[model samples]
Target: MPDLHSIPYLVGAGIVLLHVIGILHVIHAIMTVRTSQGTIAWMVSLIAAPWIAVPIYWVAGRSRFSGYVRARRSDDAELLKLSDDMHRRLREYEIKPDDAFGRAAQFLGGLPFTRGNELTLLIDGEETFESIFKAIHAAEKYLLVNFFIVKNDRIGTRFKDALIARAKAGVQVYFLFDEIGSHRLSRSYLNEMKEAGIHCSHFGANRHWWSRLQINFRNHRKIVVADGKEGFIGGLNVGDEYLGRDQRFGAWRDTHLKLKGPSVQAIQLVFIEDWNWATDEVPDLEWTGQEHTADQVAAIIPTGPADPADSWQLVVAEAANSAQERLWIASPYFVPDGGVLTALQAAAIRGADVRILIPEKADHLLVWLSAFTYYEQTIPFGVKLYRFKKGFLHQKVILVDNKLACVSTANLDNRSFRLNFEISGLTPDPVFVGEVAEMLENDFGNSEPVKVSDFTARAFWFRLACRVARLMAPVQ
Candidate 1:
């Protein structure tokens, strides 16, 4: 018989307990993990080193968000009524689906492609913010502002002042920000907004006690709606760096969209759902929007972990698969999952010109390094990669032939595909598509084509580091 009090016997028993727990977690990962590669990675790590992997997995493993689904489907009669009313009103402007992408996007977003809409492509920060501030100043009823990051810097102060000005004018302003993204924002800033009769809250996965450990998910959407008539969506957060004022990263190149008509209400609907998630109360706002003369066809697609399927990933893969002539994408992060990467390659192989634009500078070291690993896999299959030489390319844009163009907060990475709440505005209107095309053409003119040798010629240690960084892409 073993000595019950002996240290050696106790240590052995503890190790066995950990392994049993690890095995149970492995089963859980197998059942829950979204991708086969992710499942294999978790299974190996859990079995080989449970002591370290278990905690990390507990924090970041699960792809599906808890509590959010319940909150969205809550039996709150008022919320349900508002949703039904919004849908009914939107149906009046809904356009019939003319393509596979349209049908799939509508099914995934639960919103229709609307007519009588106008989309203005706002290039870079100054133009985008100017338009946003102008709309904020002109607000007659209510304003909804949301962003992934809202630094308390120069531009942030301007943004705050704009909201305050509108709020003091008797406009109901509801501001929402991501908790982790705006962690540096002072309490005073929020208090000041509250003092001016504005409703402000931070959104995160930590709303419930059980979800505190699931901090990996983030609300990465950047949105601004004014009086439910005009809206903005894109990559620029409220910060001085986005304005190209940061010396470290000069000339911030990004894209934003100024939307009008029925599409603006669609954007507002997304904001209402997000605000409800944060505050559990929906503010009353205008549900009807005036139709613009442009009459462009557009849709707003919002995707997150609360979704039943990996919505953004499927949307991107569908974009690639549906590309007839050319597929072009520009993003700050390019660490796509296996499915997206395969789709990109398949598009190139099927005689479609596939091109990816990325920034030359390293904003996130791991993400930048991970991108290098994709060169070999992509270039061999005829896909072209370009590095923006003029400035940091932070635009999340996609062009599928001359048919569809999209500006979004979603990136070509696993984080955006699964871990973050993201939104995109897509339009097939030829005029809007032409504007997007001209903008991308100018951006492409400022970029340099990347060759396979760019990665292969790197030093052995650097290449090895890149490969190592690629392993962390799923969580990044």
Candidate 2:
């Protein structure tokens, strides 16, 4: 018999047990239906004692498509035109010499690759903010904004003010921010936006601890489209750190793209899908689209929790598998799950020039340790590694065959690949790819190579620490 004081705790445990049992039933049903290579013993245990299996699955299992749910039919018709425009860019590689990369860049991003999108890269965060704001101020009709981290800081306030002004001026603005990623924002900010007439909503931020099943699912997409003619994407977030004002990290090194073309429509569609998910509202379709160009301009690789197709991860896998000449990856967090790690090892084994870039200092101690331990195996495959001592090198850019690149908010880690909703754009334009390649080579120039000896020098406990963290990758 439990004491009266222990009732709540016991009840909580019992509820968790109940759910675990339910999940086991779900898993058993799924395994039986699919005839998976999944362990029969595990399935039996899951059915017999779900509590144990639920924890293991969360930490180590790959979630099947049947296990997750996607957006409903109400996910706005307004996205159709924008999606069509974006799809066209993805299929057609039409543009000037300024846009084309190497010969492979012409065909690498997939079928119908085109190179005609006019693009401008903004280096300064403050300048990027001002440029985007100016475009917003000048907008005549629509504005779509998406961000992974949208805080209520100085920039957020300014952005909010701008959106309110635009709303007053009658521009239809749809703002989408991830619930968990931007969890720091107060209710007041949202209330203020609604009051000011701006349409704002949050992506999956299920805080209910009882069943926050997909809290790992985050919208790591940072995009903006104005009047369906202009678009922007890249790593710039609305914060002082982005402006290089932080005393800790010296200069903020990041990239954001300014697009003047039909590609903007596709990015806009990405926003609409998320907006509809949050608000359950259908938007008007067939509005006048602003044409920015005819030359093949840009392409988008949309990623998220709602995608039933799991396209982004496949693209990454394909890029890794397709690397014949060389592969250069610059990511702040270099923890790739077993699948990606296997791909890197295989690519290196096949004699592809494989190199990875990570940050020098630890952002998250556990994640860093797990990655460092994994390095012991990677170096053996001739997979070179580097640490950008310049700052927190939080970049997720990949250059394959010295031509094509997948740049986005998605990190190479398992969290970004399978759990988070991330977006990246594909560029086949030789000019853009050339500039990007040069930038990567330059990064390798200044960064220090993380040698194998570095791992051996770590204290025994530190190495042990990473081994433990690795066990948690499945849940992450």
Clashes of each: 0, 25
Where's the lowest-lDDT run of ten residues in candidate 1?
204-213
> Can you give the lDDT of residue 118 in candidate 2?
70
Number of the top-ranking candidate, with TM-score as the measure: 1
lDDT of 2 by residue, 1-476 (tens): 87999999998999787677756666655653222334454566566667676665543444432222434343445544445555564444444323323222323322233444577656558778988998899987878888888878778888888988998898887888877778898999988888877878777532334324545556788988887667888777777777777778766667677776555655666666667666666455323334445464456666644455445555666667878888888776777766677888999999999999887866577677767877787999989999888766666787888567656777776676666766666666567778778878877887898888888888988778878887565344
lDDT per residue as tens, model 1, 6-89: 979889889999989999999999999999999999999998899999999988999998678898898978778887887889
- Model 1: lDDT equals 0.91
Regions of model 1 farther than 4 Å from truth: 1-5
In order, the Cα lDDT scores of the candidates are: 0.91, 0.68
What is the lDDT, from 0 to 100, of the residue 117 in candidate 2? Answer: 59
Worst 10 residues of 2 by lDDT: 97-106
Q: TM-scores, in order shown?
A: 0.97, 0.81
